[model samples]
Every structure is written in structure tokens, then in C-alpha cells.
Target: MHPAPSVIFFTVFSGIGFGLLVFLGLDTFYVTGWTAFVFFAIAYLCAVGGLIASTFHLGHPERAMKAFTQWRSSWLSREGVCAVVALVLMGIYGAGVVFLQVHWAILGHLGALFSLLTVFTTSMIYTQLTTIPRWNSWLTPLMFMSFSLAGGALLSGNVGSATVLILVAALIQIVLWLRGDGALARSGTTLATATGLGHIGDVRAFEPPHTGTNYLLKEFAYVVGRKHSTKLRIISIVLFAVIPVALLVFAPFSHLLAALAVVSHVAGAFATRWLFFAEAEHVVGLYYGKR
Candidate 1:
């Protein structure tokens, strides 16, 4: 699948933002007054910024709101609705907390639940795509959930939870990558099956679809070389998991290290998200005989 920059930013940034909002709502870490203000500011910036970024992925950005009406079937639409609901609940709870220093415990909890659900719906958008074998896994949602919790913990200075969740996220990432690398082969999708030519011995693309790249080639048939992808997987692990965990282990003694850990984790997670999109092999590629 095409890893559009806007969609990548939306998923990575909003996942972290919503993750932070989730922890804030659950009162997972101590925050109040100016501290609460800063946390909420960061959360809203990431979440809302991500939502706005997604609009750029649309051909008609002005009509993006029409997506909200498809909540009954489309996971993308469900994600939009969930994001709005999460933001609204958090906004109401945040107004009091940031202004009057009121926790509004119930509202906070509800917002937190919705925020997590938003992430779930976002993951479903990808997982529901049977066409993309790499994304069609329970591990995708778990990975997203873990990244959210881990990133949220890092942002809120919850070292212990961050440490554990980072480990979980890293493990899931490793396993998913290993599993995803083989998914295309195991998917039972071939040019023959895809073109309804199984009765024959083989099927292949004898001629180019066009003299130049077209929309299908540019979008659904994007490919990353195996070696380059492997290198990126290592870089992503180091950035998203290893380095952050190491820095966080020392964060209790140094404020700067704590902040650096969060930065490293965020950067790492962004790389991870990029790889996620780049590595996906949309079954549509079978039609191009690239599978």
C-alpha cells in the first residue's frame, strides 16, 4: 500500500496523542494545574493535528466530513466518529481540569475508554483489509495498543509501565515482522487465483499495464526491497524499543534522560509506523503480477 506521508503522520502522531489522553483520563500518573495543562496541550496537539493531517490524504479534503456518515460499515468512518467522541469527552473533562483544577473522575474515565477505543478503531481500519496480508492480524491492534500505552506512559513519566509496555510492543513488532514477511507467500494469492486462471498452468503479466506508472502501480503496488526493509526494521527496533527502554531505566535519576526517552520513543514509533505502511503488500499487487 502507498505510505502517504499524511496518513503515516496521522496514525503515528494521533496514536501517541490519544494514548497520552487515555492515561490522563484514567489518572494513571499524577498531573494537575500547570502540569495537567502541559500534558493536555501535548495530547490535543498530537490527536487533533493527526486528524487534520488525514484530511490531506483525501482527493477532496473539503468532503472528508462525509466519511462520518458511513460509520455503520466503514472502519475508517468508525474511526472518525470514535476520534470525535474521544476528543469531545476529553475536551469537556479537560476544560474543568485545566481551568478549575477539577479532575472530573467519571468524565475522565469515559474519555480514557473512548480514547483507547479510537485507537482500536484505527487499527481495525488496517486489520479489516484482507487485501493487505501483513495488516490482517490480531497482532496489529495489539501492537497499536501497546505503542499507545507505552508512548503514553513515557510522556507521563510512568517509567515502570513504559518499561513493560515497551517490551511488549517490541516483541509484538518483531513477531509481526517475521510473520508478515511470509504472509504474501502463505496468503494463497497468486496471479492465477487473482485473475481466475487457476484452471491453466500459470498466469503472468506478459505486457506492462502502461508505458508509464499509473495509479494502481503508484499506489497499491508500492514495494520495498527486502534488504532495505530489514535494515529499517532494525533501526525501528533500536529507536522505538531498545533505546527508549534503556534511557527510561535511567530516567528516575535524571530529568533530561526522561525527556530524551520520550523523544526517542516517539521518533522510533514514527519510524515503525512508516515501516508498517511500507511493508504492507496489498493483494491488488497480484493483478500487476508483482506478487
Candidate 2:
């Protein structure tokens, strides 16, 4: 479970895009049907674009089709399949809105439902990875849901209450991350246990297998100093969560202020996402040379 920036960007960016699409689809049921349809189309396109960009990080991109073979046991496979289903649904819904003049109560609702299911599938991709203790939590899905909604709200030009909710969710995630760190420290385990250790104290990495950093070490084994991590955590909570919420709450009630809040929230979300990846200690890291 190395921190793949490509995958990370894909997840976060596409989460935002799909969330916005869901919100727009939901709005189609209201008086803003045409506007909602336009936004939905744009959001769906962005999500698909992000998905395509994610594949560039894979070494064997040509073999990406093989990912769908393990749907029975692999969450990643399920995610891929679900993403395809959601995209198809959204495309049909968009076409109906554009050409057939379809009502929102029918196709729009179906699209929204599929979008939500897509979010669930996407969250499960990380949540199912038990080797990453930080991600193996109910909060992972909750965080994904909240952040998606937050991004959607911002994109839809409603940054008032949604930003506050996002802040609250981000705070909760930060607390959960702290708890996870404490749990890992108290587990009384070492890198050896992660490789293949049955007894408690019979785990130690006296000598690393390699003298220089390999791909595994450079990826999964990356670590930040405790002091820097703590500082970054505080900054993430403040700049990404608290301050943005404050701006959304009381930012002179001007369009310019709302726009600024949206920008701040997006930037903050990206930073928070990065920390989420950086702070996570994959069990695979133990197999490498990380402690």
C-alpha cells in the first residue's frame, strides 16, 4: 500500500466530480432542472477524465483490463466495474436530459442512485485493505461521503452550511488518525511481524535486504519526522478545516468571499488528502525496511 500520487489524485478529484454530479442530479428534481443537467454533464466528464489520468501511473497499463477478473475477492475490481456502471448510467441520463427532454423524476433519480453506489464502491477500495490499519475503519467511508458532499456543495455554489459540515467531518477524521497512530504504537510489533512473525518478541529487522532504497522503500517505506508530522497535522486541521469553515460561515456575504472559500476548501482538501496518504503506515512497509 504505497502512496501512489496518481491513484490519490484520481480518487480525490473524481470523488469531487462525481459528488458534484450527484448533487446536480438531485437538483434536477427541483425547479433548476436544466441548470442541474448542465452541471451533471460537466461533473461526469471531469470524473471520467480523472479516472483516465489514474491509469497513467500503472506500469502495465495495457493489462489494466485484467483488473476486472478478480471481482469476487478484490475490491479494486469491484470498484472498476462499479465505476463503469456509474459512468454508463450518467451518460444515458445526460443524453436524455440533452436530447429527449426527459423529466428529472425518472432518469435523474436513477443516475443519483448509481452515483451514490459508485461512491460506496470507491470508498471500499481503500477500506477493504486491512493491511492499512488507518484505512480499515468505518470512518473511511464516512470521510469519503462527507468530503464528496462537501466538494459537491462547493462546486454547486452553495458554500454556506456545506463547508461547516466538511470542517466537522475533517476534524473527526483527524481525531481518528490520531487514535490510529496511538494504536499502532501500542501494538508492540515490529517490521518483522509484518513480514512473517508469529511470536510477539521474535520480530526484528537487524539488517535490511538492500543497501540502497528500492521502489518498495521509496514508496511504502517513506516516513516523516514526528515533529514535522505533528505540525503538518495541525496545519491541515486549521487551514483545511477550521479556517475554511469560518470563512464559509462569515465571509461578508459576498460572492467574492464565497468564491475564495471554495478555493480555500479545495486546496485544503488536497492537502488533507495528501496527509491522509503520507500518515498511513502500510503493513507492506514493514516487509520493506521501514520500522
Query: Using lDDT as the measure, which candidate wins?
Result: 1
Q: For residues 16-50, what per-residue lDDT tens digits would candidate 1 score against the true structure? A: 89999998999887667888999999999999999
What are the clashing pairs of model 2? Answer: none
List candidate 2 segments past 4 Å from native. Answer: 28-34, 98-101, 186-203, 252-254, 287-289
Against the true structure, candidate 2 reaches a TM-score of 0.85
Model 1: worst 10 consecutive residues (lDDT sum): 247-256
**Clash count of each predicted structure:** 0, 0
Please give, for residues 54-135, the per-residue lDDT of candidate 2 as tens digits.
Answer: 8989899899999888989887788787777767776776666666666445556666666767777788887776767777
Q: Best candidate, TM-score-wise?
A: 1
